[model samples]
Target: MYDVSPVQLLIIAAAGLITSVIGGVAGYGTGALMPLVLVPIVGAEPVVPIIALSAIFNNVSRATLFRDLVDWRRVRLVILPALPTCALGAWGYTLLDGRGALVVIGSMLVLSVPLRRTLKGRGVTLGNGALATSAAGWGVLVGGTSGAGIILISLLMAAGLEGAAVIATDAAVSTVMGVLKFGVFGVSGVITAQVVAVGLLMGVIAVPGAWLAKRLTERLPLRVHTAILDAVVITGGAAMLFRAATF
Candidate 1:
């Protein structure tokens, strides 16, 4: 376990609050920001569990705020394909080094935007087998990379979801993904007691931040919120690529 100073803890808490707000509003940015912000403070080895915990807390808050807007049909569409694949990816993650995983994750982040745009307005019907395969791909990718939520969110947006429905359903699906990832991390011995404590402390800060963002999203202009979300995603993707190159 790495030792975090009081000042560093404060910084992390502040970052967590900001991350939570972005995630609550957009349902994507927090996970992407976690590695960039927390790894230096807590050390790289501890980042995975911290991200997993934060994802769970962030999604929980988003789900609560937009419970009424959740789209079960779309949620099922993504998860049915993503869950099993995520588990397999998680298993593979434990067997591989961080650098290899980072390369794949970074590439995925960079490509996700164009991929989403290409699929937009296609109206491809996803049957059970197709859904499962897609979900599995997402899961594996998510399990391997810290920013899977961004890819999933882009796909959902491309599928024509809007407003609270997108946020709520994304939160619901992320909740499941986070929980499963947490279990995988535990089984892989990556989640230590110190890591859990720090993650939970960060989560406590995230809850209020998520609530504030949810309230703001209710009142703010949709274009402004979406613009901010897009900026965050682009920033995150760039950061991931940088890390892949340097780490």
Candidate 2:
């Protein structure tokens, strides 16, 4: 029931386009940026809905662009754990205030980097139990923070997936995660007509941006692509911290 101005709608659309490109090229970071920027524009109540919708669009774009390279096995590993924990996190989010939720989410984002780096290339093959536990943890974290892609990206990289495969599988998993989060938000009364309308408008623009990113991805060197992703992760993590503190 929130009323968005024409200028605000345009801003949201532009943010969506930019976030899609970042998500498409980097495999993460879009969600981290969404709540940070949109919360102030639309207020905290609509932030999760906007983020969920944007995520749904982002994943759809990524899935469409990299359909051929998706790794089903990797996707399973992340989704298995993420689904349930995300639900729990979403439920918790509905009960908490924006600042409280942001604090929790922001801390997770900042902590995930060190966690990923320490765990990176360690050859720690996750069994069923480990996978489920990690997924639940990530889901809860992502449900609150909107950065579900972070854990999955790190796991995929550590699992030794190549460039296209990593992006494709991550996108596929994000699609599922986004759907779950959207449902949770909808049921919690967080998603409204205005939020959906603005989100869908943004989604329309995101498709092209994602496609452009995919084309760009093809031209970049592997190291350069990875560096870009790393930068996004670090920058996003920092942004989350700043937002949590200030807001």
Worst 10-residue lDDT window for candidate 1 reads: 120-129
Off by over 4 Å in 2: 1-3, 121-129, 221-247
Q: Put down candidate 2 lDDT per residue, 1-247, tens digits, no spaces.
A: 3467888888888877877777777777676666556766765556666777777777887887799999887678778878888888887777867666666656655676667667765666665566656777778877766665767777776666767788898889878977888898888887778888877876788889889889877675656655565565566556655776787
Cα error, residue 112 of model 2, in Å, equals: 3.1
Summed backbone clashes in each candidate are: 5, 1
Q: List TM-score per model, in order.
A: 0.84, 0.84
Cα miss at 114, model 1 (Å)?
Answer: 4.4
Local accuracy by lDDT, each model: 0.74, 0.73
Q: Could you tell me how far off, in angstroms, the CA of residue 164 lies in candidate 1 after the best superposition?
A: 0.8
TM-score of model 1 vs. true structure: 0.84
